[model samples]
Target: MLVFIDESGDPGFKVSKGSSPAFVLALVAFSDRAVSLEVQAAIDAVSKQLRVFPEFKFSKSRPEIRDAFFDAVLPFDFCIRAIAVQKERIQSGYLRSNKEAFYSFFVKSMLKFDNGLLKDARIVIDGSGERVFKQELSSYLRRHTEKGAIRSVRFSDSRNDRLVQLADMCTGAIARSYRDNRDDADRWRQMIKAKIEDVWDFR
Candidate 1:
């Protein structure tokens, strides 16, 4: 199994200090590696068609570009399992005070509930943080998750990793859906509803 992970929102608890109310992590799994190439091609095509410079990001994309992106990759085979948490519901001080811990806990939670899709899977996450934290995250997932659920964990730059970009797009779509302020908040998720395995609202 091959998986790419990305998150749409920051893990900060300051909702009144410009922090996002909800933080989301999206796990995109492809059972067959070759099929991912097809999706990558579709993403590349859309990027070129829309003149999306550098890369595709859900927050930066135009309405038409977002719609076209979801439409372009709809026929592919993949499962999107995600977890979204509202900051107010979280009562743990450790998780709230430490951003990395908050990120790591939720990341492990996302994979722990895998529906038989994870086993010795090579997981890649959007590259962030320094080398030490990256290594710590890898070790943390291994120690916390079900045995053999993670074969390895790697961090990649989203600009170079197309599948990681896909995760970003999907994560963005999901996080947008949770924000009630936007008029078209529901629009993106509805476009890719078929591929979403579940959108768990973590309490």
Candidate 2:
């Protein structure tokens, strides 16, 4: 199995200072490596059909492109699990102030709900942070997931990995549902509702 991880919002809890009210981390798991390739190919094809760049980042893509991307890949075999943390409802001062701790906690929280599906899975995460932080995050996930279930934990640039991009898109869709400011918050989400295995909302 192959699993790609990504997050949608910043880990800051300054909601009163224009920070996002909720943060979302998502996991996109493919049961077969072939399916992963198939999904990547589909996304590339869609980008060509729409006459856009082959590399699609959820945050940078327009809503129409995002919708088309999701619609193109939903027919493939994959499962998504996500955790949405509402910053305002969190009561722990330590978690609120420590960005790394908060991020580590939420990532583990989301992975713990995977049941046995993630067994022997190779996990890749967006490698946008500092090298040390990425190493720490990998170790954190390795220590917390089911014993021996995670075969390896590695970091890759989202621009170079289609699976990581897919995870980003999934995270964006889940996070958008919680954004009250967006008029089309749920539009992209409804496209892949069936593929979402679970979405844990941390109040």
Candidate 3:
């Protein structure tokens, strides 16, 4: 299946000292046809649960989203995974820099299932950090895929393709998860870790 991985928050590296609880990443997977329906349904559910529109602008006041959003989104026909890295973990060397840690987490988890989609998948990820995120992920997929080739995937804000917007929704979820449970940092980390490793295959 094609996966679109995106991150939310500052990855703890944004600010050196003050409450560095901003690093979070969510890895969302989708089959070709399932992307649109599955993502929108989950988003709509979250919006309804919160009584606030999902399209809340970045500059707008933050809205409280229910945890059910994450819980409900995971059981779709397509796979959905999230990783919420805390600043404390990174500062303590528990996790690498945000991008590198996400690369390791995503490639390792995603490469496990040898489905029809993985063999000829078109992975779409959000644009981040000089577009290095997309390029690095494409490279990892090439190295790991059976044919060593990832189909055409681009990273941009262009609404022509709906996956980009879906990815942003997933990113919002990850950020919300971290922001909601700032006191239970370890729990959040473990929850994220378990989800990512749940589908891991070493072969």
Candidate 4:
């Protein structure tokens, strides 16, 4: 099993001039068919409700966005967790500007998974296109994780993307949610926190 997590928009203090939403944090969990069916079913139902078809995906050009049940949903559906960083916070300099600070925040967000759900499981993260950063992060995980059981960390740029595509969906869901209802943002954060606790005893 592999877990794919991602975020959309920058949490950086420098928000693009026209950007309304500043940042989003998202996490997605992936598994093989046998265990992924129920989650897939729920996702399909949701997609149908939203009428998102195949075209929703960027990989395929002119892809038709049919209901997952109408045709089929991605083999993997995500628990889909996310948080939107408030614009006021960014303008006020409450968040850090350095890249490491941004990444560390994501690490803490995703660590909600059971401490060791990642123990032996490989972790595939969407690459940031920076070899130096990737290498440094991989080494850091190895040094900090449990002896002989550290989960692998990887990055995938837009060119070679599958896991990243899925992560995109999770991030997109969060983006849409935040865009639609700012009030629910707090609830979304709480859901992520609760999910972290739910999986804490998973092992």
Q: Residue 19 lDDT in model 4?
A: 46
Q: Give per-residue lDDT, candidate 4, residue 190.
A: 38
Show the colliding residue pairs in model 1.
none
What is the lDDT of every predicted structure here? Answer: 0.92, 0.86, 0.50, 0.50
Query: What lDDT is obtained when candidate 4 is compared to the true structure?
Result: 0.50
- In angstroms, how far off is 105's CA in candidate 3? 7.4
- Weakest 10 consecutive residues, lDDT, candidate 1? 111-120
Kindly list the per-residue Cα lDDT of model 1 for residues 87-189, writing each as its tens digit: 8999999999999999999999999887777988999999999899999999999998899889999999999988999999999999999889999999999
* Clashing residue pairs in candidate 3 (N, C-alpha, C atoms within 3 angstroms): 11-23
> For this target, which candidate reaches the highest lDDT against the unseen true structure?
1
Over 4 Å off, model 1: none
lDDT of 2 by residue, 1-203 (tens): 99999998898877778778789999999989999999988977897899876577777889888988888998999999888988888999999899999998998878876766788889898887788988898888888888877888898887788888899989998888987778988877888799998888886
Give the RMSD in angstroms, all C-alphas superposed, for model 3.
6.5
- lDDT tens string, model 4, 27-62? 566545454555545545655566655323422322
Tell me the TM-score of each prediction against the true structure.
Answer: 0.97, 0.94, 0.53, 0.59
Q: Candidate 1: lDDT of 34?
A: 94
lDDT of 3 by residue, 61-166 (tens): 2423324444555555554555445544444353445546544454544543444435455666665555675576666666666674356555654233345544
